[model samples]
Target: MLRIAVPNKGSLSEPAVQLLKEAGYSQRRDGRALVHVDERNDVEFFYLRPRDVAVYVGQGIVDVGITGRDLLIDSGAPAIEHLELGFGGSTFRYAAPAGVAASVQDIHGKRVATSYPRLVTEHLAQFGVEADVVRLDGAVESSVRLGVADVVADVVSTGTTLRAAGLDIFGDPILKSEAVLIRDERSDAEKIAVLTGRLRGVLTARRFVLVDYDVPGDRLEEAIAVSPGFEAPTVTPLHGSDWQAVRVMVPRADINDIMDRLYAVGARAILATELLAVRV
Candidate 1:
């Protein structure tokens, strides 16, 4: 059976679990359960801390795992990213009290506090600057105010928290992070491929919607140009009439605009439906 590691809690946890469930994997119903077995799928899930997910996969304790890109890099684990999960998006950056620091160079020889000490250290080294990296577990934004550090490097989802703490982000983002599927080099290739395929299906389903419409035969080319789908739109003749039925998958983000364009091209009976699952 393939063994998978899941984030037990934090921003990456719920979304990761939901994605697995959508991909037809068994997940723990209660938060207290550490291990979940899916006999039907021949797989087992081990719930661990988000940061530890990479460690387990890198050690070959789990065949694969899901975690954030920032956490994976901070851990310096041997595990490699198999797929980007497309959620839990955030940026890692250097922040200080207003104008206290303006650029990466200003951080040189200053005390830098962060939950991700390894990531902070490496980023500073790339700029040829050195600093005392003060590692803290949480509340990194408050570190400078509390007099523990001069600068803080942490995840920035919005500038709200930094503003509330009298801190402002400085320098370019150290890393753009999101939930990702990670795997060890020793994992079984066949099992990993199957799991990756299922998750890819779920991602595609979430991003697109199925559209159906009827268009006058003479205007078929115009309608197809408005919503040409993956590969091409499916066109079928409407029995005994000078009309055609068209089926296509369009990006969910542009559904409204596509519908308006189709209407302009003389297409009627246009309908858009959510996709529950897709393979391509």
Candidate 2:
């Protein structure tokens, strides 16, 4: 059985589970359950803290895992990134009391608090600035207000938490984070192939939807040109001789606009449906 690690808490967990479930894997039934078996695929799921996912995969205790890019890099674990899952978007940045100097170089010899000590240390090192890194698991933004650190290196999603703490972000971002799929370097070829194929199908389906419609026979070429699928649009003759049925894949975000254009071009009976998975 293939073992996969998934986040147990925080912003990335629910979405990660949903994606896996949509891909036909069952997450652990009990909230506190650490391990689960998906009888259909014969795969094991391991619920883990986000920060520890990369470490577990790196050690080959799990074949693959889902985690934030920031946590994976911060853990400094030896693993290979397999895919960027396109969710849990955020940035790792330096934030200090508002009106402080605006660059990492200004924090030389200062103290920085963060849960990601390795990422902070490496980022600051690039600027030739040496700051003492005080590690904290949470409440990183509050450290600056309490004088425990001169600045805080933390994940900023909306900048709301930082602003509420009276801190302002400075310097270029240390790293941009999103959910990613990662695999152990030592994973077997069969496991790698199976997981990669399933994940690609899931990711592709997440970005697109299946669209079907009817159009006049004369307008078929124009409609096909606009509504091209991953390869080619599927077309079938309608009951009426002068009409045809068209089915294609369209990007999820462009559905409305594309539908409007197709309508203006004589498309009718348009329908949009969710895709379970798409492989090309």
Candidate 3:
């Protein structure tokens, strides 16, 4: 059985669970259940703290896991990113009291606080600055005002928390973060392949939809040129002989624009539907 770890709480947890469900993995069958078993695939899911996910996966206690990119970097875990899941996106940055004169170089020889010590340390190293890294689990922004640390390295979603703490972002970003599927280096090849395939299918389904419509034979070439499918549009002769039925797969984001273009080109009866998955 393949083992996977998922966040049990925090910003990335719910969306991670929903994405897994959409990928045909059931979760929350019983309230408060921390582990879920996928009967069809002999897979086991371990619901763990967000910070611990990368540690478990990196240690090979679990074959794979989902966690924020920031958390992964903070954990300093050796794991390969299997896929960027594209949710819970944010950035790691330095923040200081509003109106304070602070720059990346200003922190040299000063104390900095952060939940992500490893990421902060590495980032600071690149700037040739030696600052004491104060590791705090939460309320990192308060460290600046309290004078416990000169600056803080933390995740910024909308900069709301930073502003509420009377802090402003400074310098270039330390790291850009998003949810990612990752696997341990020691994971078996077969399991890795299976997991990657399933994740790819889910990712593909999220980005695209099936589009079907009818057009005159003369317009077939134009329609194909306008909205080509993954490879080519599916075309079949219609009863009128001069008409053809066309079906294609298009990115969901491009659907509206493509549909308008198709309409302008004389296509009719256009329909669009979500895709569950696309296996290549």
Candidate 4:
């Protein structure tokens, strides 16, 4: 059985659970459930705080974990990213009360507040600049106003929170982050690959859709040119003659344009379906 650690709360939890459910694994219906056993799949899931996920996986307490990339870096855990989950997205950046520092260099020897102290310290080290890093539990953006620190390093999603607090972002982003699957540097490779393959199927399903359409047999080649799939398009003959049906998978972002082109090229009955799951 594969052992998995999932986020207990915050932005990453729900989507992580949904991904597992989509991969044909059983997940606990209630958030308070500490552990769940998917007997059919021979997997066990443990719910833990997002920040602690990397530690557990790194310590070999769990075979794999899902956590924010930022948290993993801050924890300094010995875990390798098994896959990028593409959710719980955010940016880690340095901000200050509007115009305090023009760049990261200007903030040298000043106070910087952050929930992610380790990441902030490590980032500044790369620039050969060190400062007083004030660690706060939450509401890091307010630390500057409250006089705990002159500048702040924290997660910026829309920049609204920073602006509301009269802060402005400065410097290049410290780190771009999103939720990711992680495993200890040393682990059971074959078992991890099985779980990784299942999740990859879910990720692929979310990214693409199934498209079906009909066209005159002669125009089939033309229609296919509009939406050729990753593999060869599935072409089939129609019931009464002179026509054929075509089916292919296309990226969700290009579906509307593909539909338009297929129709213009003499295709009919075009349809696209949301894929629940895919293997490849």
lDDT of each: 0.93, 0.90, 0.88, 0.91
Candidate with better TM-score, 1 vs 3: 1
| Stretches of candidate 3 exceeding 4 Å from the true structure | 98-102
> Model 1 scores what on Cα lDDT?
0.93
| Deviation of model 4 at 8, angstroms | 0.6
What lDDT score is found at residue 67 in candidate 2? 97
- RMSD from true fold, candidate 2: 1.5
Candidate 4 local lDDT, 197-235, one digit each (tens): 989988998889999999999998888888889687999
Q: What lDDT score goes with residue 79 in model 2?
A: 78
TM-score of each: 0.98, 0.95, 0.94, 0.96
Q: What is the C-alpha RMSD of each candidate to the true structure, in Å?
A: 0.8, 1.5, 1.7, 1.3
Q: In candidate 3, how many Å is residue 164 off?
A: 3.1
**Of the pair 1 and 4, which is ahead by lDDT?**
1
lDDT tens per residue, model 2, 1-280 = 8899999999999999998887778788789998899878989999999999999999999999999988888999997888989899998999998667588888898899999999899898888999899999989988988889988999888899999999988888899989999999888769767877887899899889999999999999888877887788989998747899999999999999889989999999999999889777
Extract clashing residue pairs from model 2: none
Clashing pairs in 4: none
lDDT-sorted candidate list, best first: 1, 4, 2, 3
Better of 2 and 3 by lDDT: 2
Residue-by-residue lDDT tens digits, candidate 1, 69-144: 9999999999999899899999998899877799999998999999999999999999999999999999988898
Between prediction 1 and prediction 2, which has the larger lDDT? 1
**Residue 113 displacement in candidate 3 (angstroms):** 1.7
Decoy 1 TM-score against native: 0.98
